[model samples]
Target: MSERRTIAIAGGGIGGLIAALALARGGMRVLVYERAARFAPFGAGIQLSPNASRVLYAFGLGKALATAASEPEGLIVRRGRDAQELARGPLKGFMGQRYGAPYLILHRADLHTILRVATEKEIDIDIEMGTAVADFALHKNGVTVLTERDHQLEEHRVAALIGADGLRSTVRARMFGNDQPRPAERTAWRALVPADQLPPEFAANNVGLWLGHDAHLVHYPLRGGSVINVVAVVADAWQATWTGDGWNSPGDKDELAGRFSAWAPQVRDLIDSLPSVTRWALADRKPLRRWGEGAVTLLGDAAHPMLPFLAQGGGMAIEDAMTLGRCLVRGEDVAVALRKYERLRRYRTARVQREARRMDRIYHYSNPMAALRDMVMGARSGQKMIERYNWLYRHKS
Candidate 1:
């Protein structure tokens, strides 16, 4: 019998988990190393548009997601100060029917749990929590992931190593030494509260985006509409030192509430309603010309991090996983497969990264520019509005 090749993945995040499942389905033996002691619930909610949802479904997660995620009726764009409707784009039936898959919004923990559970069920996969890769050594035949657990050095050999470790990836650091993430000069305050704590409008089954000067707010129901996930991103000074604390930095509720005090009462109330907030210093790296070196490569944010303005960070990572699984499963030369995967994804991911930056500017436009943005949004018909996102949602891996 031919020996089964093993693929090692660092950072068992959503992207890593998804990639593991995808590769296992393609008959590759897979191992995942996660630094967390357990796959605990962290972070806020996320949106899984059709492009990503379809990939998860392909991995046999349709029913799991159907129950854990809420399909929003549509995306409503509003003026942050007065809450005036700027544009409405359908999502639930419209996006699903149009794109052949539904657009889902769910708590990050819920989605993580779903992926974690699905990955655990795979026979060809193994997961090691509390294990962090210290570095990697690449060779012509395979790669070795080096780690130290309990004061002992451990080495893992695999046909390829995927650095899904996210923004501050150790694998990426080994490949390209001393590359740091560039702050987008913004901060995000995220919180999830019970739906009943919010007013009916805010608790509605839709994705609501309130845009203002140098700031924006997004909220939607999650876990079958029992809880509402809210995120407030604003242009702020980089208060926290660029330590290892990339995201999940502590935030003060008073400071967050005060930031939105000038907005409409309804918008302001949501910020005040949170018991506390988790602040994340928004940052990203410039798109790399290549993703990996030899038998090792990068994935997700480790390859191309971007602003969340486009809400496609997760989607892009999910897309990368699917393409990667396909390329590796083709049984081509390991180097060729890794290079092929990078070629297939580099342009699209870079484009998304650039578009996300563009959105950051547009969403934070002030005075005349903001007014002009509202005018343009209001002018686009509902269908036309959806059409703008078609290129994003209709994508299939």
Candidate 2:
């Protein structure tokens, strides 16, 4: 392949891998640099809204996803203190019928595997493990990328460079200068439990959300109903003291149980039954006015890290990959194409980011505000509740 037809991507996570598959299908040679020696099943469950599922199916991942993902029956919202049902929204068949795609809930690792396996099958994609994108320089011909591996450096010239690296992105820091991500002052504790270990109420084929004071809980079945993925978010003052390497740090089960002690018995029992748990501090950055310059840009968490309240983090990243691939394959100028991709994605992503932060506040309401929230939620029909997010679910890239 001509050097002018080659593109380099940093970070082989979901965004980078999906971008590789999309680019290769567009007849461009792709080089993916992943710092990890091997891919590990790290994160917990992720929800795939229709907007994201559309892109995955377009990339020909429908079969793999069908086998690995589960479409929940619906979503049930309840009060954490008394287990009072607030609202139940349609998901499984309703989502597909209305949005043209299904709402899927599955293990994050499974989706990563589906993307990785698809990328590996493409003849034009090459993955370099244990390598990181150290830096890059833009020249008249293209962008020259510097990659570091085991104290050694190598240079490769590609038509454009894409930074799909996560929160602490090296490529992003190099372009925009180093700055810390804003901490949300919240901690997320995650765990996976055997489906059989819990009572029948917890094993139902749907997503459960419990709202409380300064905390919220979300649980859903994963891995074809054999395991349940649980995530609890709570206000915490210990974020400043944490010195973990990455997001997945050991969590104290007792401490986690204590946080939910005042919750309903089912919720309390769910926490106590966990064999182990991992925790990560929740953080996000204000939307960037510009995501990239010249022939380089960012995708996924690297570009727009947001609070998980909206469940659109991975979905937005998937949309970015599809848009970037389409722009590059149009045979436009490399720098111009990148700018176009950013222009198309920046506004929508920023809105999602802002909305997620707003949801964070609503989910952890207290006293009068909590009561009002419940009353308003209860008045809306489940179908109307699902329809409220048509702008988010009906998107196509």
Candidate 3:
């Protein structure tokens, strides 16, 4: 019997590219439609925890990633006001030995470039940039993808559709009407500065998280330790008036400095020294019981958008791509394959989503509650702290 081999993937981000590569490796053809004119190195840095790293290694990009990525020695959780270390967890050799893959931190652009290059090399994958998927229709045999480019609407038929389109996914909206992303009541600012541009303190080869009242700051080395990627997430009064396009909007360093004015002097100095910053409002959709209908389904943020507190958003999306590809290759029917994929991923992603939200609250605790939280965190040994997240980092799919 002929296999349902051609798949349409909306979005060209990490998830979409990974899906394309994974599906192509399964001997299926892939078409990726991206709205960007080109796949430029965009966004700040992202951490690839052991769970996601395992998937990438399985995809055979281990060597490339190892060379391009910075493996942080460990994570240091600190009090945002005083820079006092609350807890520490190993990530370098410890994670590799424990989880069979090392934890990596790298520029988002570097990761995307690696995946995009890998996808381009596959014979069955084709990518179209500047083409946005406007809508899609599900049919008995396949899906018809409607895209808009240069004000022209075009349609293409495929055996299936994968909505890896990210947080504000059009395919997701069209599939389940009335579903819109809700602001997570947080805004983030990111800046990547050259290592030489910052003080020796910021050049540490470890991931640092400073948790404060209603705010948190994360920083780690990126691009093999040549740069430091810093992110600040704070409770903001900004309304949801943003139209989604303003994400990654150019931000003023002064405005960000004002927000972190009362933070530790080190943090304030870091913010002041940033050459520039980009601001984004974090938004997420409520988890859905099921992510697809017929031969179409959602992946990544489209399927489950969550808070960034857990640092597993990208990891979960990577796992989704691998699992979906494997299901498609194993199942005899397209719809059945997608259903199995959804079933396998829905619970896991939802749990991560909930955990992320919990982390958001935990990281923003204040005063007496904050002191109690610190004691609890400090009570755990580094190994125990890492073990606590073993369920998350040790996940295979």
- Best-fitting candidate, measured by lDDT? 2
Q: For model 1, what is the error of residue 73's alpha carbon versus the real structure, in angstroms, after optimal superposition?
A: 0.6
What residue runs in model 2 are displaced by over 4 Å at the alpha carbon?
Answer: none
Best by TM-score: 2
Deviation in Å, model 2, residue 239 alpha carbon: 2.0
| Candidate 1 lDDT over residue span 204-265, tens digit each | 99999998888999999888888888999988856456465446677899988888888988
Off by over 4 Å in 1: 1-4, 239-246
Question: Candidate 3 versus the native: TM-score?
Answer: 0.96
lDDT per residue for candidate 2 within 1-397, as digits (tens), equals: 9877899999999899999988999999999999998899868899999999999999888999999999999999998989999899999999999999999999999999998889889999999999999999999878999999998999999999999999999989999988999899889999999999999878899999999888999999999899999999999856788776765588999999999999999999999999999888899999999999899999999999999999999999999999999999999999999999999999999999999999999988888898898889988888898898999999999
lDDT of each: 0.87, 0.94, 0.87
User: Residue 76 of candidate 3: its Cα lDDT?
Assistant: 89
- Cα lDDT over the full model 3: 0.87
As a whole number from 0 to 100, the lDDT of residue 219 in candidate 2 is 93
lDDT for model 1: 0.87
